[model samples]
Each structure stands twice: as structure tokens, then as C-alpha cells.
Target chain A: AQSVTQLDSQVPVFEEAPVELRCNYSSSVSVYLFWYVQYPNQGLQLLLKYLSGSTLVKGINGFEAEFNKSQTSFHLRKPSVHISDTAEYFCAVTPTGFQKLVFGTGTRLLVSP
Target chain B: EAGVAQSPRYKIIEKRQSVAFWCNPISGHATLYWYQQILGQGPKLLIQFQNNGVVDDSQLPKDRFSAERLKGVDSTLKIQPAKLEDSAVYLCASSVGLAGGPPRETQYFGPGTRLLVL
Candidate 1:
């Protein structure tokens, strides 16, 4: 079985400021990682994913994540966040050969003006 | 392309009542998924369907929950004698499932149906 941990329950940031949401996972086999965002009253949307090659993966809305194999981390980062970036972010993991995704609790990104 | 679609964006029912949710996945998508999202928590997979056939339903509570996708395109999930704990957002997602391809396809999600049990 696989599990995900998002230590931060909430992250507060000012508009145009840099932000990073941490995500870590535990899996015995190689896995694919993904980050999804959910706005108020909306469903989860894929932000980015890390499957194979290139440890650094970029996503929509100028967001990006770096897959640190040794650290077991796939932290989402944005150079400058906008007010619209305020949403709930979820991290998910699935084994390389499987399609069942295990998700983390989620991190609420609060972007203020 | 259109994303996934779910019905009754918001539903409120009393405890022990029965509720059902409808979902229509993207055209041509062979895989569909149902997830439950509680407040302040990430979405949890309740079931996965591969073209009208169930692939996984291990986490679903069979005593109260039941789901079916008879046509391989649309699906319905039902909860009988619901409990307060069943109050959550039910999300429907779909992804392209090509035979002999990697299983890492990106899943597209619907707006979800919010179920509140009073």
C-alpha cells in the first residue's frame, strides 16, 4: 500500500509572492506523482505530474514541482502567486504499473491581496 | 473537449435517507472513477470502472454504497440509509485508457456533487 503526507494543512501568502507546497510519499515500488488544485465549489484539476525523466516538472499557471527521489518529495512551487491561486492543493501517488491513486490530505493555499 | 459531468451539483438529505449521483464521463474515455472528498481532506477513491465493468471497489462500503456503469459511458452511485459521515463531495473523473499503454494517463475531473446530510 502507498500513502501521501502533506504536512502543511494551510499555507498563507501575499499576492505576487513565492509559494511552495510540500508533498511526500511512501511506496515500495516506483510511482508516478501528481498535483491537483481545487477551487471553491470546483473539482480537482491536474496541476502537474512526474512520471519519467527530468526530475523537474512544470505545470499550468506558472507552477512547477521537483521530484526529489532521495528525499521522497514532490514539492509544488510557483515563483509568484496570484489571488486566483488561492485554492486547495492535493498530492497523489500511484505505482508505475497501476492506476489506483492515493492522495494526501491536502493543503489550502490562501493568497491574500 | 468536454470534461467529466455530474448531476445535481448540490444535494441535501436527511440521515438514513437514500441518495444517488449521476455521472457522464468524457466521450471515448474507457475508464471512469468515483471519489469521495470530505471537508479539509483530499479525494479518496471509492470505485474505478473500466468500460462498464468494475475494476476496483475495495474501499466502498457494500452495506450502504452501490455503484454501476452498465453502458460503459455513464454511471450512478447510490447510498442507502446514509449516515452523517456520508456527507461529502462526490467527484467523478475519467481518463483515456488505451489498451497496452501505460496506466499513467491524466484524469479529468467534474465539478462534483456536494451531499449534505442533516
Candidate 2:
């Protein structure tokens, strides 16, 4: 079984400031990584995914994540955040050749004006 | 393309009551999924269907939960004698199914049905 751990449950950052949401995972074999964002009263939207590619992957909303195999991390980061970035973020992983995605608890990103 | 659709955006019922949720997947999609999401937690897979046949339902609580997809299009999930802990959001997702029968695939989700068991 695979699991994800998001160290920070909440993050408050000033508008236009850079922010990072930490994520770590434990798996016996190779895994695929993903990030999803949930807006208030809405379904989750895929932010980015790290499949077979370069270490750094860019996603919508100017967000990006780096796939670090050694550290087992895929932290999401953005150079500048807007108030609209306030939402619950989730880190997810799935074992190679498996379709079931296991997700972390979540980190609430609060962008203050 | 139309997205997955779910009915009864909000539901409230007492413990021991029964409730059912309906979902209509995107046109031509052959794979459907049902997930349960408790507050402050990510969604957990309850069942998966390839067309009308179930592919995986290991996480579903058979004692009180049931799900089915007929005609390989729309799906329904029912919970009998619901418990207080059943208060959570029920999410529906659908995929194009494995192209060339590949195992891993990405999924598109619905808005979800929020259930509150009193």
C-alpha cells in the first residue's frame, strides 16, 4: 500500500509572495505523483502530474512541482500567489501500473491580501 | 464534452435511514467510479466499474453500501441504515476506460453529493 504525508496542514502567505506545500510519500515501488486543488463548494481539479518526464513539471495557474525520487517528494510551488489561490490542496500517488490513487490529508493554502 | 453529473447536491437524513445517489458519466465513457470523502480528508475509492461490470469494490462496506451501473452509462450508489459516520461527500468520476486495455488511466470527477447523517 502507498501513502502520502503533507507536513503542513495550513499555510498563510501574502499575496504576490512565493509559497510551497510540502509533500512526502512512502511506497515500496515506483509511483506516479499528482496534485489536485479544491475550490470552495467545488470538485477537485487536477493541478499537475509527474509521470515519466523531466524532474520539474509545470501546471496550470503558474504552479509547478519537482519529482525528487531520492527524497520521495513532489512539493508544489508558485512564485506569486493570488487571493484566488486560497483553497485546499492535496497530494496523491499511485503505484506503477495501478490505477488507484492514494491521497494525502491536504494542506489549506490561504493567500492573504 | 459534458462532465460527470450527480444529483441531490445536498442530502440530510437521520441515522438508520436509507439514501441513494445518482451519477451520469460523460458520454461514451466506459469506466465509472464512486468515492467517499470525509471532512478534512481526501476522497477514498468505494467502487469502480467498467461498463456494467464491476472491476474493483474492495473498499466498499458491503454491509450497507451498494453501487451499480446499468446500460454502461449512469450509476447509482445506495446506503441502507446509514450511520453517523457516513456523513461525507460522495464523489462520482468517469474515465474513457483503458485505451488498448491499459491499466492505469486518468479520471474526471463530478461535483459530488454532500450527505449529512444525523
TM agreement with the true structure for every prediction: 0.98, 0.96
> Model 2 over residues B1-98: C-alpha lDDT tens digits?
88889998999999999999999988988889899999999889899898999988999999999998978999999999899999999999888896
lDDT tens digits by residue: candidate 2, A5-109 = 999999999999999999999999998898989898887888988878799999999999999999999999999999999999999998887767788999999
On residues B26-47, what C-alpha lDDT tens digit does candidate 1 reach at each position? 9999999999999878899999
Best by lDDT: 1
Q: After superposition, how far is residue B66 of candidate 1 from its true place, in Å?
A: 0.6
Chain A TM-score for each of the predictions: 0.98, 0.98
lDDT agreement with native, every candidate: 0.93, 0.91
For model 1, the superposed segments whose C-alpha errors exceed 4 Å read B100-102
Interface RMSD of each: 1.6, 2.1
- Candidate 2 lDDT at A18 equals 98
User: lDDT of model 1 at residue B55?
Assistant: 84
